[model samples]
Target: MNKELITDITKYQEFYPPNSLKAINNVLKWKNSEEELQGTIEALTFIVNQTLMKIIPEGRIVFCTMLERLDGRFVLLDEIQGVLNLNNNQMGKNIDELKNMG
Candidate 1:
């Protein structure tokens, strides 16, 4: 499957109305293998970290907290290192730094 589609799906989540609660499946409608789903969330977390910072810094921090919780439970070692292989974009670098932390 194309990774860009996953990234696009993550961005599409932002278009949905602000709801009090939404299942992750609802947020990511496309079914993925467990690994693909986790990878998509990782991608979203990195992208959101940059955008949310500029738009809503407090929200960015809150989102990061949420990502931290998810990462604690599901993120993998190879996923972190794989981020380093992406283009030298800010989000990629941010993710790489996050990898360094663990």
Candidate 2:
């Protein structure tokens, strides 16, 4: 795995635990196999969505919006920004505006 990707995955360990990382790594090791990669991606996506929902419910929507974009499903970035807006009141004051700073 690339160092940056490994670092990113490691950052999620608190949420996913080491066992989840092992499973994901095993699956990604076989990523050269098309079927395996597809299955692994599906499983990982599920785990990610579930974990994020618990950690940050509003962020889950934003993450899913990006996931759709990653999957080439034609999601508009603005739509994701809108979801963030709706959830921002619960998040914090000034947070909604901060998101647009990107």
Candidate 3:
């Protein structure tokens, strides 16, 4: 399972770049399979979901639709990037600010 998570993180690193993706990959690689990676994925997922809740500020219905479109493989880094991009668009509202407010 740990190896699997490392593999996923590695993919994320490739999908992203020299950023948190690398940091996450490094962290996952260093920790023991029995220790760190055990619940790291779930924890990250939870954190991402919480952030999504802050961004949408609505019920799970819309969230589920978005997740389904992403095929259950959405990563926190990608979601944050999406929110940041949206915030930087014409609306010009930072997601971090909204998250902080919540």
Best by lDDT: 2
For model 2, give the 10-residue run with minimal summed lDDT: 1-10
TM-score of every candidate = 0.27, 0.26, 0.27
lDDT of 2 by residue, 1-102 (tens): 222221123334554422334456566674345565566567877887675445354455345435634665666878655555554466443334335532
Task: Please list the C-alpha lDDT of all candidates, in the order they appear.
Answer: 0.46, 0.48, 0.41
RMSD of each: 15.0, 14.5, 15.7
Over 41-95, each residue of candidate 1 has an lDDT whose tens digit, in order, gives 6677777566533433323332353354584587665764444334436554454
Sequence-dependent TM-score of model 1: 0.27
RMSD of 1: 15.0
Off by over 4 Å in 2: 1-32, 57-102
Q: Which residue pairs of candidate 3 clash? A: none
TM-score of model 3 vs. true structure: 0.27
Candidate 3, superposed: residue stretches over 4 Å from native: 1-29, 57-102
Q: Could you arrange the candidates by TM-score from highest to lowest? A: 1, 3, 2
The most accurate candidate by TM-score is 1
Note the clash tally of each candidate: 0, 0, 0
Answer with 2 or 3, whichever has the higher lDDT. Answer: 2
In candidate 1, which residue ranges exceed 4 Å CA deviation?
A: 1-29, 56-102
TM-score of decoy 2: 0.26
